[model samples]
Target chain A: MSGFSATLGHRSYEFADLRVLLAKATPLRSGDVLAGIAAGSAEERVAAQLCLADVPLERFLTDMVVPWEDDAVTRLILERHDPVAFASVRALTVGELRDWLLDYDTDAAALSAVAAGLTPEMVAAVSKLMGNQDLILVASKCAVVTAFRSTIGLPGRMAVRLQPNHPTDDLRGVAASIVDGLLYGCGDAVIGVNPVSDSPARCRELLDLLDGLIHEYAIPTQGCVLAHLTTTLRCMDRGAPVDLVFQSIAGTEATNRSFGITLELLAEAHAAARELGRGTVGEQAMYFETGQGSSLSAGAHHGVDQQTLEARAYGVARAFDPLLVNSVVGFIGPEYLATGKQVIRAGLEDHFCGKVLGLPMGCDVCYTNHMDVDQDDMDSLLTLLAVAGCNFVIAVPGADDVMLGYQSLSFHDAQYARQVLGLRPAPEFEDWLTGQGLLGTDGRLVMPPARHALLADPSGRPSSALPPG
Target chain B: MIPDEWSALRAMTPARIALGRAGSSTPTRARLAFALDHARARGAVNEPFAVADIARELARRSGPAVLSVRSAVRDRDEYLLNPALGGRLDDASRAEVDAAAGHPGTAPDLVVVLGDGLSAGAVNDQGVAVALAVGDAMGERGWAVGPFVIVRNGRVAVGDEIGARLGARFVVVLIGERPGLGATRSLGAYVTLDPRPGRTDAERNCISNIRPGGTSVADGATRIVELLTRARAAGTTGVALNP
Candidate 1:
């Protein structure tokens, strides 16, 4: 079958024969005809031409010269982008930002700084205008350093966080999620729980249980009950086994005060936790969480942009020499960032800024219900952040963070990342998993010989069939 | 291009007063600006002050030193909820101020204190500028200035007790103003003569909106010093003392 011809720039080229489209019976323009043929073909020769040929994709789209404007072909060609939204984004510059994004060879840090310098709305709009190829080009060309920083108990290996949250402080329900994640070869960096009850005693009880789990399973994971520094300090005073001290920090002093945390207090908590020497694997014993919205939400941003303020919070977090500093990116609802596009851009900016600041950065790729997001949105963001060399990701059961009332990565999502991205759990935890016959030498997970007994009994004897570590 | 109808008007102020709308909604640019400003307003109200940090910064900037004090308001939460409590000093704070006042060379002809007020962020951003300007203006006029004091969980009137304790003839307070959408970093100055604990807002004269956009620090400082001079001569502030 004959395919259509189109003029791109100054050159005229013929598209390859779209083998599946038998006839061109319509009076559509060559672009529209090519789009329909592209949509209908098994080989997708026309679609390939649209990408591979010197087709001037941006120019063609910007000219608004579509013959069949209402057709699916036109929509696909435009990436289903909102015309008004794209126009607004394009109005910012004459393809300067797009060219910057397209220049994959540009320094990742430079690109990140540029990305961060943009307003959140600009970032969000640009991201919405990007096609799959544009995203891939951007993600692939960036540097990927394996484990730029490490948490305690994990050394130069990709880590996964197990967030076992429960509404009633039920250890059993929390244990179920933790066991599920652990069995899937997750929870290498830390097993941090967001507890529903704010009581120090209740948090201390959960910390004690995690301590027992870590020892009994010989899991190379530190435990943190995400209570306030004061609550965690009280837990320490009571001689509870607290592995990592946790605090919610913001950019400015006043914002920290509103949250009842101060830099001096953080320093004190860091020193107290360090003196306790609870973490067995690494020297650092503090963990911090920050987000762009907190400063504004807490009324302390000082009229500084949220990204800059967020970076300032990282400065505060890094001073404590934390084991892991995760940006709960979209955990705050839509008030600060209204859509998934904004959340993803903020996640990348946070990752880049945190990495630049020399902190072991991770992202709780999450969103509340009020935001314009879903599981798929989180999946896309999680994949991009992982590819951006994020230190760790939050792994909860079923992508549900019940206690926090948000959605995060699921245990399966962790496995999927390791499989697709060639990422591995923290080295020590990987060794433990292999010793338990749960992971093969190739780093792929294997069915346990005795799945039932292993989960039921944390102290169960190692199977003789287990691979020697 | 046709001249924008509001071009000259918009240049006069940062406030989005006469921005044209689009079919009953704010235009995209105007709406986004409004949102950003609204966010700034919210941020100012919610920010907390690390009083020690501000004091250390003040000490670094100049001499005399910086003293830390607290109001009767126990914490930021209480301070936000109970405006009345923020107006007075706590017992321990009173003792500290009195003890410090007893130290030799601590008393001065003028006492200045900075408070976190409704916008701690404002105080942090503009407090130092306004304070330096006031101090330099006072120094040039040959007025003896006391150590800079930073009070946490305090309102504007808390400076009265601080000034009275030090036995200064005049007290000047630079506090974070209640933020507006366009002016989150505005710091307000409250000047009083013969400072006492029971002084009310009516007994003090205010020079407000002291920031880059509203009132420049130099102008605000001059206003404060001028008000103080007049208040000292009149032996009063408020309606009785005119600049």
Candidate 2:
């Protein structure tokens, strides 16, 4: 393996290989420190970044992080490289790529045109050398949109995935949260639920509930039960109304194995979801969730840094053409991110990498109670992501997920993001909200009357509380 | 003010709902309420465990004798930073375990360990009650239950090493779960058969959310006993055994 070296003042720093260089160059995160691969000092990290900047971008194409034969994620990345798109930036160094990305001339169209030419490694390497502002600025210029029942990632638009989880999957409890989110104009991305159990029967019950609600109200949004792939496939086998097949994916084959998934299995699930023909606006049927430290948590990172590995997981997501790919950034706890600042940096980096690779990236800007983070930290990250043009964000009823036991943004937080940034929900969803009189002409959520129709019974009959509409 | 109609929905679930907004933001009272719960949960994680007091209380009960030990972790920061360290015994504690379980003759039928996991409040408040109840149930079943090992700053896998050293056939670890804003002092029970090192979560059966408002101590004890009985009959636990 070839070595990389740089000198800071009188001292020289040498990295043993490309993997080591990538690990040391990554900004401070606790996961790499726990993995025992982080740079020894701040100066050493700067040295590695200096060395990483001079490396030609083409070198990433040849020097694989995980061996090509040992990992299918690597194979997919290499096999799908578009040489025609690479011809334009063939000779740029990693440093030059950073400069080019931030150049005023590089607009959304320019970034989209070269999306296929870059691999996860190239993107991850360049991200290591960029600052947080640089990440947001470049990511803001790259637009990757997709649609199902509603559109996402469109310019001047932000969506919310209504996460109405219940501890026991009670239909009425879930219904209450759904009603809260709908009134606040917050389920445009998808009305997703993280079930307490992974059983097919339980998943089917929730899916039926969501499907029925969407149909009854004629809501311009899709529904997803975040269950395992096999469980969802079983639900589909039972002829349940399945809209999206969801799974948690990782960067390496070993980590994917720990998740009980493989590339072939994902392809199978993708084809199966498409065959159902449930999508009305588009065929992107996959929804994947990734994070910074999942690979290390599974003991499958192979000495690679967590941020780089996170980018590689984006590689897996892009192959499936997912409708939603979110990084549950802080839910993994303080072990990976450690503090509020670390979580904020990671959220921006993930959004930038996924968007650069041409995927509709969202963020679950959240934190577990055990971590040294709070709602204030979440507010910072959420505002930054909205500014960076994130496709969507996960919102619960009151920023408190009683079922999952974490703090995320509230439905009101999404409205706040959209309101301050001059962003709207997906067009179809905004139209639906307007028609239902939940959105005012001024683009703000109007408080529904004490007897709104959405608060009616599950049988679609008006409750006594509902006045004649 | 909350509308009268939302009362029915609020009563259905513990989730925070119908929190009236303040112009695209959480109302001041709702935000402050959430902040208070978050502070309580964070305090639960950082609160020190009164292990000595709990050990004395357990020893006074008419069940198994209580023995106290510590994991490899020195403090809360280390415990939060590197979880792998929390899953093993320190050298001194390992020696203490070796001296306590003399000669490793016949493996005991069961070993119950009380670990102060993320929330010390969980173990302090409910750990003794659950341990004594479980010990009594196991005794009624005519099983040889070893002394309860109260571990400080311990993780779930710490029971594996302690049980393996004591030569126990099965180990049940009653520990604090990661504190949630809604439930700060929630306890969990993890049962592993033929306890040893390197046992993954797939090799254990778990009963979680044991507290006053959640799973009662009596119900948790009954479930643990049932799982143990089934494990003994099937000669396995975890993914292999049906609970």
Candidate 3:
């Protein structure tokens, strides 16, 4: 293309045709930028090497509670990778196991390979982020434990979250559909469902549904399935103290999904601490987890825009309620910012334990060996997150979710929180980890919260960091 | 509007740019090929081509007085990633444009070019309206507009390069807008003073977009005359005194 204006002496550009342009085009947009950050490149590499023996996280969550399930993924992997058993494994069996892997697996590697790659630091982290399960069984058990120990401890917050508007797609809408709408959708695959609506308008509809079921309960809750919803501090109505989840700008970007889960626990505990401080001990759990745990999409990494930062700072300024985020999901991987680390460390040095916790969802391998964050200095960082008030860790059975994995193992955070904090054992932990399925019965470990004896108890006090003779 | 006399203008291929296969309906494929080839050929030799060249093969037009046009896009970081700054070549852009101008005193009448390397699709979506707006903006003073140029994979420099070459006293680049998720294609504008590449955004006068939200080129006509009149008076273009 060429041209020139005699008087103006200006040149003009031309195009030979349009079809050539179409040939060179392949629909492009900004979302594609997150293709790898969410779950890609790293998945393939990590999946190939995982083995059941290394699933460190799987072990701690259900240590002897209900029961454990056999490692279906591992068994299938073994049957294939193992030349001796390859032929013995039937096509139908492999297909079923493959389907299971698709449902539960956060990566592509075998379970044992996942374990072998872990460093000691990662093991501690995965072990911690193992709670926050949605299994009806675990939630009921934990609620009972928390209820019994109400006078002495703040058991664990049984938080739930849901979006108000039920969009057929995306994480927020899906979670909300199940929780508030009570309608089953894609959300059942990711988070649990609750029929409770926080919006006054929608709640009225729920109240109507409860008209017939009220034959036995007090505050109409027939259709109100307990769900988690997070709102900005400003959004909270001082009078009613409730807000829808999506409206709150917390974790708006993809990197801050943990904020939602942590908020869930904080909401519950903070409200209780205030009431208990005021001698209102029997206020019926103060609608804690019913409207907590609003997690961000954790889908994009636009690096904190102005809006995103404002939202985060706002959430932080407002102290967390102890009910939903009674526990936090801290970062032990590459995404951990110095800013976040400083805040968490201050909380720890100041000795605020019940407020937040860390579970190294993404271990070193997930970061570098796996290529997620590329942070060579991650091993030492894990120690810092732990020091910052992180109690439970979430490593795989024998493996650790490395940094390069990003949030590939983030789901494990809730697992460790529920398993370790609530003190439930194998079967219960197993049930939630793998869901209530046939395989949910094997290889579970639900180590109960070791209680301390008033007299000479090893359980009551933290183990002597003083070293054995 | 080749001067009523230099109408016998013949086409010439630029020394720096390579003409790819223009064997199709749209030149975009050829543009993309050029970019990819430049990148690949320059391989470890370099990472980014940083420069591209394409001349309008107008069958017949103006005389050959050898002119250079280019824009020094200041706040490079902001422009590369930001969709908002697409309207004008930043301060640094002016400096670069000035430097590229072998002769800055001889200003050209019109500087036309495409910009905001967002995407060709974005340009197609937003550029046309912006062009019309610029045209209307230039109409008030009865300042006659010449021809328009749209470059693919274009950044601010392409404007500077052509403006410098065309020898126009005034030049404006209607560029492509950055593509977001829902709004992938949009348009922008860039104007240059003295129609030279090295001059800064301050030296130039611009009413972006041939459409609203910008000084539509149609509306820009009167404004362009006013700017030229002011430049003729102030003898400069910068933060201090630009029309």
- Clashing residue pairs found in predicted model 2: none
Q: lDDT by residue for model 1 over A1-469, one digit each (tens)? A: 2344655577554544321211121111122221233233323333333432322223434432222252222233244334543442343342355466676455556553443233322332233234444544554444323221133222224578888776566765666566556666778878898887668889977988788878766667788899888999998899998888999987666787888877668878988988876555566788889887676656454433465457657656656777888899887655566667778777777776566445677889887643555666787888887776677888775565555545677666777777777777777677888888878898776654344434333433232111121
Residue A186, candidate 2: Cα error in Å is 0.7
Native interface contacts kept by each candidate, as a fraction: 0.00, 0.74, 0.00
Rank ordering of all candidates by lDDT, starting from the highest:
2, 1, 3
lDDT of 2 by residue, B93-163 (tens): 99988777846575678899999899999999999888888888988899988888999999999999999
For model 2, residues A1-469, the per-residue Cα lDDT tens digits are 5899897789999999899999999999999999999999999999999999999989989899899999999999999889888877879999999999999999999999898999999999999999999999999999999988898999999999999999998877787788878888999999999999998998988998899889988998899999999899999999999999999999999999999999999999999998988877887889999999999999999999999999999999999999999999999978899999999999999999999999999999999988889888998999999999999999998898989998889998899999999899999999999998899878988877756778655554333222122
What residue pairs are clashing in model 1? A254-B47, A254-B48, A254-B49, A255-B48, A298-B46, A299-B43, A299-B46, A299-B47
Q: Pick the candidate with the highest DockQ.
A: 2
Off by over 4 Å in 1: A1-157, A451-453, A457-469, B1-243
What is the TM-score of chain A, computed separately for every candidate? 0.67, 0.97, 0.24
Q: Using alpha carbons, what is the TM-score of model 2?
A: 0.97
Docking class of 3: incorrect
Q: Give the runs in model 3 whose Cα sits over 4 Å from its true position.
A: A1-182, A186-231, A237-241, A244-469, B1-96, B99-116, B138-243
lDDT of 2 at A452: 71
- Model 1 error, position A384 (Å): 0.7
The CA lDDT of each predicted structure is 0.64, 0.90, 0.29
TM-score, each model?
0.47, 0.97, 0.28
